[model samples]
Target: MRNKNSRNNREVMKRILGCIRPYWFLVLLSLLLAVITVVLTLYIPILTGQAVDLIVGKGDVNFTGLLAVIRNIAVAIAGTAVAQWFMNHINNKITYHIVQDLRTRTFHHLQVLPLSYIDAHPAGDLISRVITDIEQFSDGLLMGFTQLFTGVITIVGTILFMLSINLWITLVVVCLSPLSFFIAGFISKKTFTMFKKQSETRGELTGLTDEMLGNLKVVQAFGHQEKAQEEFEEINSRLAEYSLKATFFSSITNPATRFMYAAIYAGVTIAGCFTVIGGGLTIGQLTSFLSYTNQYTKPFNEITGVITELQNSLASAARVFQLLDEPALLKDVPGAPALENVQGKVSLNQVYFSYLPEVRLIEDFNLDVCPGQRIAIVGPTGCGKTTVINLLMRFYDVTGGSISVDGCDIREVTRESLRTNYGMVLQETWLKSGTIRENIAYGSPDASEEEIIQAAREAHAHSFIMRMPDGYDTVIGEDGGSLSQGQKQLLCIARVMLNLPPMLILDEATSSIDTMTEIRIQKAFAKMMKGRTSFIVAHRLSTIRESDVILVMKDGHIIEQGTHESLLEKGGFYAELYNSQFAPAG
Candidate 1:
């Protein structure tokens, strides 16, 4: 298990590096600046030691030489600071660009993913992965690059200078260095376990919050606020617990490592004093040696601090990779033909399907519709009505058998081409954040103003749209939230009208509207359905009385099929359902 985790960490690191590959030049430039900055900064210690030696050897302060040395050292420090600032600026640029690439790739993948994948994952969790996780990854990379580059250079340069001054003290420093690393490693190992758990809990909290808040209307309608709060508190408590543990461990790492380094420094000073007293080491050399010891150990401390942050970053990266590595979504077959000049004849032959393998939702489903026929499918809530539409639209692929349009298998045609041949309006209306005119002309981007007005008129939505603040140009809020439910549905109908495809699907399309408005919309739909193949899924028997044929579905099977009058006379399941809707009260 340990080996597997190590391998996974390496894989995640590799993918993250790939994101930086495009910005390699910027990264290299930052490193170049880092080297220059560290080299110039190192000169300060050497210059100070030389000044000490000059003043002490003459037993008198050389104010002229001392002033000159101080001036040069001050200039070098200022230059080093400027170079450090430029390196930081470039590092930030690289970090943001890499984050942008990650966000773009994740969003594009979401677009191409099959609807099944979207339905299976929570919207909030996916949002966390795309936004929150990527930001965390960016922060870690920023710190890792900023400190790691200069820290490495400082360690190497300090050691080489120390070797030139005194080898014995340098060896003593080297032996004690591993103690800090071991202490850091011990703390990091324990903290990583806690941090990983904390991250997962945080994602779950985000998902729950999104789910509850996204459906706040339902929660309030059912008086579930207390229950919701309780659930939130429970999860919040768990998150606090894990976060406390992770933070506590990381917090102690620094002081614990620092204590060890202080002891090493004390030992080095004592040993250097003996050498100085024995006339083997000069006072200037001792001064420089002490400076080098501090410089050499500083990187380990910075690295230890960064390692704690990296644990959180790696946890977030694993989650992002998990989302990205989901099974590739359904795609158009290679060299698939484009659907064109559709005649609207559709068939589902021996189709079988299930949301889960152990629980079948559809089996042996067979249906055939001739060109320009009006078919109404009536079924209870879970009888696969929406599933049928999902399969027809290729939003999901069938597990068995095939769906075809004009004898061409849907899987063999490009999804974009196949979907373009049909217009659909669902019970759940969806409108983007746009003007009324833009919503109506969504699919038909090139539609003229006159054509858009005509489509709105056909869907019985023109009057309300004209009443808005900007008339037809009125901007709608997201999902048409500013408009009433009926108004949103009407706009969706207008969108479909503008498309005017050869095939049409109306899934409880007018369920939210009043009787009078529904009557007008139905009249308009009747005219629209005149020469188009149409599928209507409605629970109201009154709406389908004029359908050429009605299918009654139950338990994923078509239990009955006939006209309204024929099914009523037969007195079967469809007859029972139709009568129940209109049954007189006791």
Candidate 2:
């Protein structure tokens, strides 16, 4: 398992390195500066060695010469700092561009992915992949890697310099480095486990937050505040524990690395003293060699940590790529055509559909309509009413048979074009946090002001909209909370009206509205459906009693279909349903 993890770590590092592949020249340039800095910085220690030799040899101590050496060392250090700063700046800029490129590509890829993929993934989980996961590349990969490379180079260069001074001592110091590296590697690997757990847990927390906010009304109505808070606290406590563990794991790296440095430094110092006392090395050379050792060991700790850092980075990148790599299950043929200027004549021929395999929801359903026809689907709860709309909209493709618009297979037309001549008002109206006008205009963004007002007026929303503080410009709170349920539904209706699709879908559009409001909406819908094909799904059967045709469904199959009056005469499911309502009316 350890070996497999290590191998995975190496592979991830390789993939992350690919992000920098396009900017290989920039990386090389930065490394050139870093190497130059390391080289110049090493010169200062060597200069110190010469000064030490001058003093130890009892040579005439020229104060001016000593001062000049000090100044030169200072100047060299300053230059090295500048070079290192430039390296960081350039690399950071390049990483930003790379991350930006990756984000753009990932988001674009998501746009083309099938609804199934999104359905399976929580929005927040997917969002974390795009935003949080990619952020790790910047946080852990780009900077971490460059430092690792620089450290390796500096360490290797310093070792060679030490070897030039004394090969035997150089070998001894080099031997200690493996121990330092191994300990650092081990610690970092542990840290990687903590990071993985923390990242996954954080994603779940975010998903939970998103899910709860989406159903805020249910939460409030059920008075789940204390329960929700308790649950959140429990998750938060778990997250806190994992986060602290990750922090501690990473925290050990620095102090442990410093301990390694201390050990190496002590050994080198003791070894140098013996060499000096035996006249095997000059004081200056030993001092300079010690400086090189410090430089070498400092970077060794950094380089050894690359495996752990790369593991986390690669895991993040892989998640992002996983999202991007998904194939769009819903796609038009290569030569797919536009739906064309449609007549709104829709047909479902032998439609069979299911949300899940075991739960068949629509079975061999058939429907046909001439242009400008009004049809309503009325059924008991879970009788596949919404599933019919799902089929019509091609939200999920049919498992059997096909739906057509104007006699052309919907599958053969581009989804965008096929959906252009259709409009929907869902039971749950989704309003953006925008002005009333903006929410309505979303249907036809290019609509003129006059058109917007006309649609709002048609839907009976203009009067209430005008009563708001800013009228059309009133900024809606989250999900249109500022407005009443009836007002929000009316706004959605106006939005659908603004689009003026020849075929319309009202999926319980007025189910949440009062009877008076429903009557007003029904009047507006009557006008809207006059010269267009429309399908209405409603539990309030009165909402569709005047429809040209009514279809009754049960357990995924249609049991009855005829004119409303004809169905009432037949005394089947539709008649029973109608009588159940009217029996209570009188």
Question: What TM-score fits each model?
Answer: 0.96, 0.93
Off by over 4 Å in 1: 57-59
Q: Which residue ranges in model 2 land beyond 4 Å of their true spot?
A: 1-11, 55-59, 304-311
Candidate 1 lDDT over 1-586, as tens digits, reads 5677668778988998898899999989998999899888888888878778768866688889899989989998999999999999998898888888888988888888778889988888888889888888888888888888888889888888888888888888988888888889888888877877887888888999999987899999999999999999998999999999999999998999889888988998999999999997888778878888888878878988889888778888888888888876767888999999999999999999888899989899999999899999998889998888888888888999999999999999999998898889999988999899988999999999999999999999999988888998888788896799999999999999887889989999889899999999999899989889999999887999999889999988889998999999999999889879999998
Which numbered prediction scores highest in TM-score against the true structure?
1
Q: How well is each residue in 1-586 modelled by candidate 2, as lDDT tens digits?
A: 6787667667666666776799888878888988887788778888898777766656568677788888888899899899888888887877888899889988888887877678888887888888998998667667564686688678878987898788878888888877766777778778777777777777778887888888788999999978988987887888899889877876677678779888988999999899989988988899989988889887866665555565567667767766776886666799898887789888899988887899777887888988998888988999899878877887788999999999998898888886788889999888998788889999678889999999999998889989889889989987897678888889999998887878899999998888887888889899888889999898888899888988898898879999998998998889999989879654
Candidate 1 lDDT at 41 equals 83
